[model samples]
Target chain A: MAQKTIAGVNLEVTEDGYLENPSLWTEEIAKEIAKEEGIELTEKHFEVIKFIRENAEAGLTIRKVGKSGIVDIKGFYDLFPGGPLKISTKIAGIKKPASCV
Target chain B: MKKILILGAGTGGTIMANKLRKSLDREEWDITIVDKHKTHYYQPGFLFIPFGIYNKQDVIKPKANFIPAGVNLIYSDIDKVVAEENKVLLEGGKVLNYDFLIVATGTRVDPDETPGLKGELWHKEIFDFYTVEGALALQEYFETWKGGKLVMSIAELPFKCPVAPLEFVFLADEYFTKVGIRDKVDITYVTPLPGAFTKPKATKMLGALLEEKNIKVIPDFYLESVDNKEKKIKSYDGLEIPFDVLTIVPVNKGDDMVERSGMGDDLNFIPTDKHTLRSEKYENIFVLGDASNIPTSKAGSVVHFAAEVLFDNLLCAIKGRELRAKFDGHANCYIETGFGKGSLIDFNYETEPLPGTYPLPGIGPFGLLQNTKMNHYGKVIFRWIYWHMLLKGKELPVENHMSMAGKKKS
Candidate 1:
């Protein structure tokens, strides 16, 4: 089924991430979610990607990170100098771009 | 001439100092390790203290005994770390400069973070196992009380040894059982999280155990205020969890100096690279243990594993090379399930504690997700590992990385 609109969208996003191959889209979904969170891409996504991917089997949800969103984005920016897109995409299962090295 | 200054001669600082000392030649580098306290603690042993398994004498020894022979050890409280200047100011009127600094200063409990916790009921009706005084006092209270509403709780998240609360409950069950009042006492576990643990498998397993033990599990209860006058805990959601005796894992924060230095997250944890164990903000600084805001459980084992990766990365830093070594937040812990049995979980950033044998898949020893005596032995024997191997930064025969070896696969 297609995603429900508006209020239902957030709940549907969770099911969408859960039903999809999380290892494949953990980065993508996390990035898309970060978009909704009013944040841009940065190296910080790498940490959350690995954390979410590893925790997927144990149910570390984007909703959960959003709920406990005490994680400082600026702190993350400081943590990884790599751009968020590169970090998120890589942890999302993309190869490390040569420039990142 | 490069000068290296290490703050907090505790587990993290001592290990980093030892590791760096081995890498930096004495002729070219000068290393100084500092802390106000002379005694070092096997903090993991703090869990066993309440059960009368560990005493003050057993858990502490001289910090000087652990520092390497050549490294200079300074006994002083650090005022702050000036990252821009690459210097640390001590409690005295002395300023120490360094070419590079490692902030291995780990964390401790701040019961004051919550109102009335440290106020009236501290060490009386309310207690924490995170410290020696709290655990020892709780032990005395445990013996004195016949039985009442005993609530085991965590004030907030990000506590060291997340499994310690579960272990406390399991052992509390046996403690009540041994005291011959298991039937009289009521055990209720309250937490901010929605389950018995952060991991689902362990929660389902432990939730079932709580049922078997007749213990109540209250999930998603954020503590709003502690009513010491009434001896009850009020949640933001307005759900009240009442108790005759309260055991809490108070809110944990990174060392205060992290805040003073202006190099920490809101919770005062240093911002560190999750994979490389390098400080993302400052190239010269490296953080390990509870000092970093890494998502891994702030257990000693995570530090033990991160130490090796940090060791390799620091070498790269010295050579002006890229930090190639990666840390996956590998933390392995044994969850004691009471009686003579326990559960073992070995996992990394992406893996959960699956049902499998550990370190050697399909092996004869150390079963995962299942309770066994060998795992119980692993829990008890970790004391030896913490003292002789971990604090010294010695490599365990096991791989520094998490292995899928002994784990069972579907």
Candidate 2:
């Protein structure tokens, strides 16, 4: 774990740059993280992010987000570009999805 | 008499029946186990079938053989569990009431979930080794395959026996090499995950091994559909890879009975308390094995370990005590790297697989995260252990919870 400053607040983060404490999340923090990933946070992005933050504990998956009624999987891929689940969870101020390794 | 109903007499439910029967008084309790199928498959051996290392007979036995005498075994299709009514409706209108319910209805591979996957070429050019039929079909196909673009693709995430796909390619490489068609076969592994595996360290190790075997890996390719006309698989993002023969781990979902009961997630896997193995919505209903939406590999090793935790917790619940045992999401897997060599990994919820020894520190007969002949033997001998020790709920040397004794933090 390493400490990094995001949105003028020092926070602990994992090696993958996921927030160590999701409770420290704010709308401003999400914007800063999105900017780091070279993505512009739009209202549609925020809708997916909000859904991700709320359901983070239930285990986040691209399939789950696709079925979230807010967006389809293709639209989600359009939102987060490279790896939708990985990027969206980072912007949502949550840990990366832990599938069985 | 009070009843304890266990559904799906596979590895998990069978073990639970044996364990609970020994602990609970037979005079006071009536234990019944039910499943539609009569044969209990040693699923781990299904991986060996395609390679001709084992056959259908080696992997299967009568479900009644492992079932204990005191427990009632019913071979009937399950209709649904009326959770609120504390009763289960069986096919042909039989009702079985339960004081407590244990759900162990494991997952099934649904090739139909993918478009054109079960199309005209199914079981001919395309196959899945997850089922007995699929394994046998693939074995027959491999017998005379001239070998070209043998693509092993995973259709979805969180499928049972996560290591099986990796093992399949490894074995395919060896089988082709031995049969003198190694150069002709263009082997590729396609998965939705970013790498060969989910965890960092294990991915690095396995990825290196795949490269060493001259296997090409196409990562981040989520299967959208299979194109029968073009003989290719298309990803959601419009990437397509042509294949001569496609060995797929199709979309795995929990039994339809779970959906009929109205007690499952989108995948039909019951929402379960990860630690306690109890159903999140129904207090009296507990979930075990692949049927539960737990963040762990859906493997027999997981069911074997989780059974111990569930046994303790269920005993506590029966005594009106707090559920004490917590399942650490422990899963042990032996990765068959082919050529009679294999690798082993031991991991839990919070810990990733570390390289070291297993079951013993500094003096392990089995190496962890390291490929060795001993690990291969461990996997081979596991068949005996599965049939004799594991399913019978006999105590093994390994503990239920994961131990970090021999593991080294990187």
Candidate 3:
């Protein structure tokens, strides 16, 4: 496995980019996360993003923000329960942290 | 010149800290918060972690992110709260003095409370996802594992999110299929409750969905112990369930500091008035979130609604006025059924989940009770709001009070 790093979010490629089966949950992915366009991830960054994703899936959208592009962010949500944290990590492109196993 | 000291910066503590920060004047009052860790978890995401839906980064962020600046954020474990003296002693022996107190130290998962649950297979064949390590480890374990009897159990109630185990089973069914092993894995969701959920209406809807997905639901089964050698879960009533991969939502109790300080009840939760969010005995003290003995789901919605009431009530307290703000036990939950859609339910102590459009009457881009892609979209979009809005103590477009504009009495 080749260990790769990006802005503190690490990715360990057992193969090429992403695994064909992804039967792999690596340490790097758990540490830092990958983020999407215009949003970058640092070790200190992901706290709030995961909060919204999980709470939204739980059926309570506690929105008090500007309405413009509010619906546009529908693509930003990961509704598959924990998908927000996973996607935030994915979009952040960071790997797992050291404290965890 | 009164000082308010809050112990533990979890959902209850964070919201209360923010509420008090806005309610009291900087000149007349001082508020200080204490906790050992730095990251704040969107705990509900733990259920999704094992299913590979939420990664570790999804559920976590620096604890400092949520605490509004200017309010003192003490990064240390509380040695004990001297309730009689109105002072908090930290692990480092630093002392925090308070004229008023709010005990929001949240719950802890006790795997040791369950016999053999924390033994040999703790993170191997058996795991608990209440924490980051447990959830991530299980997610990794699920990756290479073949399925047999995937038994998910909830040892007791007053757990953080009451609906999480059910959500886990539902998502697992969906996950196995997406991984091309749905037929190979047999999942049995084991619950301590007589119903699949707290409310009857939501239970009926949720239970039926469980059955519709070909997953079995065993209700009212008391968990006495787990037999690691036999790979079976033995209930107090003598029912035995076999499993290959076991996920346990361990016994959740309040932070030990609460018990050590003589501030909490038997389960370590602070005793407080259910509606007003006021500590029953102490006039200056208040409690909120999972830390309080409020009869509601410990999910984030309770905190959100409580924040609305509590922010006002705290102001009333500082002015030496009666706490008029009342929490109606309002809790709303989004139930994800997977496959690009989900169901939305909004209700409180008096209301059950009814079919209606939410935040808007019949016009929502999101639907309630019934599953919709729009509802799914609503669930997905909330992540942005959480980061940019909620923790900042800003007002959301949705009313602080649960709205009847979109919800029906039922």
TM-score of 2: 0.98
Please list the residue runs of candidate 2 whose C-alpha ends up more than 4 Å from where it truly belongs after superposition. none
Give the candidate number with the greatest DockQ. Answer: 2
RMSD each, Å? 8.3, 1.3, 22.2
Model number with the top TM-score: 2
By lDDT, rank the candidates, best first: 2, 1, 3
Candidate 1 off by > 4 Å: A1-12, A16-101
Off by over 4 Å in 3: A1-101, B408-410
Number of colliding residue pairs in each model: 9, 0, 40
- Cα displacement (Å) at residue B389, model 3: 1.0
Which candidate has the highest lDDT of all? 2
Name the lDDT value of residue A4 in candidate 3. Answer: 59
For residues B79-129, what per-residue lDDT tens digits would candidate 2 score against the true structure?
999999999999999999999999999999988888899999899999999
- DockQ per candidate, 2 decimals: 0.05, 0.65, 0.01
lDDT of 2: 0.93
Between 1 and 2, whose TM-score is larger?
2
